[model samples]
Target: MAKVKLTAVCKVCGSEIELPEDVMDGEITSCPTCGTRYIVRLKGEKVELEEFKGDVEDYGE
Candidate 1:
């Protein structure tokens, strides 16, 4: 199958970003405008971008 480029608006900067069709679910992508990272989600023919939340860990402090 041929790869198709897709577009999604950034949840942070609201910038329309082009996403690669080969991008898998849960993949992280960053916004070029605000430099915010987001997780890509695929819902049928629609695409959703969610802000990335990092997992917390203790460094034995």
Candidate 2:
């Protein structure tokens, strides 16, 4: 078995975001440049990215 990498353009910084080929739908990852969060989805054989909508908890609060 071999690993494949998937890529998407960040909606915020326009940087390319590379992800694992086995990445599942709703998996969360961050952009390296801007550190913006995104959720990945399976769009047929390809993947799509969307801004993460889940609430962020501040443990320091």
Candidate 3:
């Protein structure tokens, strides 16, 4: 499988944050410095935060 390279930013601070070691569908991870959660959003869906995991296949499998 191809690795995804996603980038996230801190809303509180103007700091540029990148995706952690691994990001899941609902695993919430925080920033090491700003302590901000990396939330993910989808179009025409519900508003919620995402999860973090070392791999993507760990979701309900």
Cα deviation at 25, candidate 2, in Å, is 0.4
List lDDT for all candidates, in order. Answer: 0.80, 0.81, 0.53
Residue lDDT tens for model 2, 1-60: 766678998999999999987788877888999988887888887878889765556311
> What's model 1's lDDT at 31?
86
When summed lDDT is taken over every stretch of 10 residues in candidate 1, the lowest stretch is 52-61
Query: What is candidate 1's lDDT per residue for 8-53, written digit by digit as tens?
Result: 9987678988888688887888888988887888999888998877
Give the total clashing residue pairs for model 1.
0
TM-scores of the candidates in the order shown:
0.75, 0.76, 0.44
Best-fitting candidate, scored by lDDT:
2
Q: Which pairs of residues collide in candidate 2?
A: none
Which residue pairs clash in candidate 1? none
Cα lDDT over the full model 3: 0.53
How many residue pairs of model 3 clash at the backbone?
A: 3
Give residue 47's error in model 3 in angstroms: 12
Deviation of model 2 at 9, angstroms: 0.6
The ten-residue window of minimal lDDT in model 2 covers 52-61
Query: Largest TM-score belongs to which candidate?
Result: 2
Candidate 1 C-alpha error for residue 4, in Å:
3.8
Q: What is the C-alpha RMSD of each candidate to the true structure, in Å?
A: 4.8, 4.2, 8.0
Model 2, CA-based lDDT: 0.81
